[model samples]
Target chain A: MKNNIISSIRLTIVMLILFSGAYTLIVWASSQLTTSHGNGDVIYFKGKKFYSNLGQKFTNDRYFNSRPSAVEYNAASSAGSNKGPSNPAYLASVQARIDTFIAHNPKIKKSEIPSDLVTASGSGLDPHISVTSALIQINRISKVRGISENALTTLISKQTEKPMAGLFGPERIHVLKLNIELDKMQ
Target chain B: MNTEIIGVILSFLVVVILAKPMGRYMGKIFSDEKTNLDFLFDPLDKLIYKLGNIDFKKEMNWKQHIVVMLTINLVWFVLAMLVLTNMGNLALNPDGNPSMSLDLALNTAISFIANTNLQHYSGETGISYLGQLVLMLFQFISAGCGIAMAVIVVNAMKEKVAHTLGNFYYLFVRSCTRILLPFSILVAILLVLNGSPMTFEGKDTITTLQDESVQVSRGPAAAFIAIKHLGTNGGGFFGANSSHPLENPNYFTNTLEIITQMLIPLAFIFAIGYMLKRKNLAWMIFGVMTVGFLLLALPTIWNEMNGNPLIEKMGINQHGNMEGKEVRFGAAASAYWSIATTVISTGSVNAMHDSFMPLSGLFQMLGMMVNAFYGGCGVGFLNFYIYIILTVFISGLMVGRTPEFLGKKIEAKEMQIAMGVTLLHPLLILTGTAFASYAYTQNPIELSAWLNNPSFHGFSEMLYEFTSSSANNGSGFEGLGDNTPFWNIASGIVMLLARFIPIIGPVAIAGSLASKKYIPESAGTLKTDTITFGLMIFIVIVIVAALSFFPALSLGPIAEYLSM
Candidate 1:
């Protein structure tokens, strides 16, 4: 048993050097060849750098809203609220978000607000909103930005990201990208 | 014909086609036989033995094996704690993350060592690059330890009346080099190519289209993620886990991650068949596990796809409950991944499990509670073997025959250990939940702070935390503020006891049976490989799990589902 323990200690040292040092070094070297070079994908929008990979918040009337964030869109601390549906605190927060949304958009009924608009996303940094969520916000955005509803609808359709290969995930629109395009529109 | 259905079918097909070859390869690697990749790893393997001063030929009894396993694990725990506690001073802290509190460090150390990778703290801001690497190391070795234990059990079953099983150090090293290392590298490269970050860098500041700046964290995430899934160590590089676009990248990478995590656990089932020369027994075990998995998975998929009925009633065009799920993996894929992750003890998530429908949460909890549906590496089989023993004893008594398995007599000593190991899971989980519940009820202001959801689901959160820990399945409902001292210390203890006891129990039984005199097969001997025995074993698993956990489930997801 003593011999076994000694051997175990020795073996661990070898594995640590191999896994933590050598193996990690090799992977890091390979990452240098990728597009982000291990930093992250950066987008230059109107002279400002934006991480295209991350979810950005938009709460203005003239723009489509991103999903709610538990961490307030902090990429360095990405997380969910971890709130279960049955938690009274969580339910209350959801109710409040729903109420706020209803007050802002009188044309949309209380029931028409999608859960995605009220609930915090898993990453708290979800970049996309449901097609219905985007459409629901269209009336407000069109009226506020003085754009035609038909033109905004065309822009939304253009911004929609279909589920990969047409059937794996869900159809949705990227809010940050959509908003950037929305700003580009006259 | 739908893409989601195609995705599921293709994934299953790949696993099926690969299982036999992977099983055969693993068997050869562990059996002291010459294999194709052996030329690449043999010299390094010998060198490791030499450096460790290990006598490669020396075999160990079960007690010695367990001791060595525990000792090495202890070394790792201490090493991990040191690294995590002092990570602020360590190199590779581009984000300047501080040292973890001692309690969180202890919990993190135990969680990784037990192969349960349960994160009381989030990965991005909570840990530095060096800490992540340390945890990644634990992922590999802990997973290797599980496979090593399984190998010992297989050795015990194969050798009749043997005094020693096999060299623990040899099997441990070989498991890492021959199986885990090669596969992890391949997957790592695939992940890197698919855009997972793999560099030692700090968080980058990015301005949004709104002209507001945000900090984006990056690291050598691809390498960690590859083995995280491959080794069934589901510790995420980001707090969001695979749900993060950077970590999962695209549909192809998502498919690859799911397939890799499920592969080894599935292949281990087949490896048992090939190694023991009991193909039928392997198939029977596989059938039972797949049926249980499907039973859990189908309902979860239906619940998510049906969307939240309440949301539907809101006069909203329900797009099938995309609340906390990635649009890239939708409802079906997220539900599928949840079942896959929980059953295999690979707790990596593509969606927030806490956000899953009430019934979906019930299935996830059930998966961990059973803990034998193609479980982690070799431990899954170890857990299932307990049920097999119980089933054999019960069925043997019913048939008026003496109980035996693999030509060895089943005695009281063996039965005692098996029963003890079997019941320990629920005891730890239930007892922990009960205590937490009592504490919450007594001091709602203090303890209720840990719960995110109040009422029935809140109780489920506490229950799920314990269940995840005790089963060595790390996926949690996530709403629980488990980083506190109470939860950290409590779940740490549970994870340690749950992991080691089941492993030790199975090995001890196998060791005891190996030393007993082998009896020749006779007409009176009961066959374990038959469909009837498989069905009996399945029933045994279900009955045991259901009886122990059904009340808890009813209070949690069941009530939530009905209320909704």
Candidate 2:
């Protein structure tokens, strides 16, 4: 009985500590909303200490996203490419981007290609891929995560974005969403 | 382009044909197979009941019923929160699909429960198929329940009704199976045919034009896409969102999505009129809703097509007004779709809403804040009924008679229910948005350089997104790069309030509406059949929504519009 009492006391103390800690976090969080929002600086890359800026953060290892960035998509310079898809120049520019991605991710072949990787999405700041686009990158991310390539490829079938109605559109995968999963250690 | 328009028109016509048969089917099922519709859907109903473990023999008093309903939803919220927080360890595949943090978990739980699918995390990257299914599936059911209840309330009001307003369990099943299921399935298949890959294969390895290693993303996208649009759940898997081909593959698909997104809410009003034996009254309601949608859509498309001056300066092609939208759909469809989706509470977008010009953004926001025509399915009839009652009261007061709706008296008790139903949305939006905006500003350390706009336009876009998301209208302003703790939680709360308060309010109203003595239809009743009353109802909704959101509007999008 005495031992049981002691364990209960310990449990209560731990609960108190946890509850207090959570309360403090919410309070601190509420306090943070006072000034401004969406100034991209808030995002922290998983396990990376430094915050990544929208511009000038290109790396060879990471799959590049953000279509036709304008002034690095700075809010102060918020605007679009203003180039319609049919614009030959825009097509040429996007084609150049496709070539660049191919140059970086060498294993990906031209024949087994996802258009989203080569063509700039309309948002230009797209953070997703059509399931096909993500599928195109499955082999590379599988290697990175040290998982079997075949197994990871199977996961894509599970992850693709479905059309709004069975008859309306195509399935897609948010690139950021899919990549985050690809980067998972387990 | 014209062909696409015609295709969209045909798709809409098809949806219109489907709506009432579906609505009647919905009504019949609520009567629990005593009616023909329920009998048709009995097998599916039993399947859902068996899976959900509903006990029809168990009769619940109103209080216990509310308690169970509220408790179950809150518990689902807690479970959703747990799934999100542990998504890294529990659901994350490899390397690091961005895990749902405590904040995101909270946000997602609230968003789903509230029927607001405002995602703080990008799809594909932020969530797994498991997470989306577990969290967003609830949204599908919650939305169906809210809509089913609206139809149930209308049926309960029929003086000649033989049954208690339909069972919630049966309604949920029938709505999901008969109405939501077919549409979602049809749409998903269409999306797959349009080139959205429906696969379990992880990102594929393929050599690019220049050989480089890349991780391709993949999944069963067709399953969720259709419902996301039809159910008015606007959560997107990718950050580029609905505009991405996977979410919205082509122009034909986009037009179909746009029409279907608005079809149910518009048709529900007619279902309501039929249930009340007032076909002309339904037409009057349609006139107001149609006019409202056009007013919002016209200005938004106009501004978007005019093209942004800053982009024009770069000497880019402005032929079809290129901005943040898919090329296949072009600017016109994207803009038009944005208006319809946001206006009707189906917030699937093919363009970056924040990137829209000032007046355009305003109209869209106004559609959400005031212009919820019938709103979500079950919720719409409840909201409109409040306005209908309010109209009866004020007009009756002026003419010196007790206000009667379908022969029922509008007393303080009924007024209170309507008033609560009406005020609930604005209050939640105002309070949650204000709290969120204030909290977001305090955390300067989190803001990235690209997101650090000094103007209210920037601030207002963020504010508008919070309001919209929390209110469960998934349309967002493209200007705000929302992927942070402040937004994740704040928007989460907004989604919660947007979804539940309206539901709770209407459920309370429906319960009350059900219990009231049925007043038979009389010859001397005030004519709700006229456009005047319909406009009056629309105007009151506008006034209440506008008054609530005005101060916040001034601080956010309005200031941005002015600067532009």
Candidate 3:
């Protein structure tokens, strides 16, 4: 029994060096070959570096809203709220979001508000929103920015990513990219 | 068929092609036979033995082996708890993540130690880099322990009568050094090259295209992600798991991840065949498992591709159920991975399970419930072996013959242990679910926070958590608010009991069988290595899992599906 414990500890230490140190070094070296170079992919925007892969917040009325973030869009601590539907607290939060959305966009009906707009995404860093989510927000954005709804609709279509192979995932728009494009339209 | 179906077929083909060689190599390594990698590992193995004062030649009986296994795991659990609870003070925490709450720490420790990897907390924010490494250590050891247990069982089965199973320390070390290490390093390199982050630096603050600044988390993710799949330890480096663009960068990496996760579990099945020199028996067993896997997978893929009926009714020209899936893998690939991960007990996901169609959720849950269908490394075969025994016992009764397996009589003691282990799976899951249900009903205000989805789907979330814990398959519905003390402690207990007891029971049964006198084959002897026996085992597995879990299934996924 004593020998087993000793051996187990020794084995763990040996494997830890191999796995944690040596293997990590090997992977680090290999990661140098990728575009990110072991750091995440960064896109330069207006003298600022941005991680293109991560979800970003867009709270301004003129800009299209990003998905609700459980972690307040803190990419450093990515996670879901992990709140089930039955939980009154979670439901209350969703209901609150719904009310807020309705308050902001009186042009859209309450039932027409997409779930993606109110519910938090699993990552809390989901950069994309369903086409419906983007479309529902178009009226508010157009009204706020003084842009024609037709042009905004066209821009939404341009930003919409079709399902992979035309039959894979859902049609969605990158919220940050769309908002950025909205800014560029000025 | 579309490219999606082709990808699935190709993935299975690769696993089948690689299984024999990998299995044979593993068999040789565990048997201490001269192998191709001996040149590299031999000196290291000896040095380890010398430094640890372990006598490689000394063997232990089943009782001793299990004690050692449990003790080593306990040691690891303690170490993990200490590290996790003190993570805020630990280095490599560039994010300065605080230490986990006591219950969360305890749950996380047990989850990883048991090779379950059920995370009540997110990876990037909840744990420091050092903590991730500690979890990684557990991943390798826990997986190695499971493989060692399986190897010991195989050794017992090979021998007609033996006092000692082979040395547990020797097998455990070799499992890590030979099988897991080399495979993980290779996969890590591939993952890194394919664009996973592998750095010690802190989170990088970045301004998005919208001119909003956000801190993007990065870490030594590639190393952890590789073994997480290869070892069937499915805890994610990021909260979004493989769904995150960084964790699984592209389709190539996605395919690699799926294949890597399935490789060891499938290879272990073949290893059993090679070690026992019963190729036919191995094929039979493999065939049964594959059939069961396909039965679960095909429907899930079809259902997910069909998209949610609720969404379809809204005139949304739906392109499959892409709600929680990554676009890179698409519905077919994500569905394929979902089923594969669950079936093999590799709980890593490229898609969010919470967003899957109700029927798809049922199939995934069933995969874990009937965990014998090519389950986790070494443990999968052990679980299946229990079913094999049960089948033999029932067949013997039906035919009015004495039940014997590999010349050892299946007596009351063996039956009791086998039944105990077999029944314990659903027992823990159902009981846990029942308790949670009762609590939810009795104290809705307090316990209601535990569920994410209300009504039928919410019940499914709770059921899936217990099932995943009890099966040691760590994937979750994700919508469940499980970070609280109630879930953390309860699931922790379930994970520990579910993992060790099943392993101990099988090892005990194998040890007892090994000590019995050998009986020569005769005309009246039941042939276990035949297709007929395989079919019987298959039927027994299905019936047992159905009998136990069918009612729960009806209330959860089935009811949700019907409503949809």
- Tell me the TM-score of each prediction against the true structure: 0.96, 0.72, 0.88
Candidate 1 per-residue lDDT over residues B35-106, each given as its tens digit? 988778989888888887888788799998998888998888889889989998988898888899999999
How does residue B434 of candidate 3 score in lDDT? 94
Chain B TM-score, candidates in order = 0.99, 0.89, 0.99
Q: What lDDT is reached at residue A177 by model 3?
A: 74
Which DockQ-derived CAPRI band holds candidate 2?
A: incorrect
What residue runs in model 2 are displaced by over 4 Å at the alpha carbon?
A1-186, B1-14, B17-20, B31-41, B51-53, B57-65, B91-98, B160-164, B210-213, B313-317, B432-452, B478-481
Q: Which parts of model 3 have CA positions greater than 4 angstroms off?
A: A32-35, A55-74, A80-186
**lDDT per residue, candidate 2, B194-313, as tens digits?**
545444344443222123333344455555666677777766655555666555555566666776676668767766665666778778877777777777776776666676544343
lDDT of 3 at B213: 70
For TM-score, candidate 1 versus 3, the one ahead is 1
Against the true two-chain complex, what DockQ does each candidate achieve? 0.55, 0.05, 0.28
User: lDDT, candidate 2, residue B489?
Assistant: 65
What overall lDDT goes with each candidate model? Answer: 0.85, 0.58, 0.83
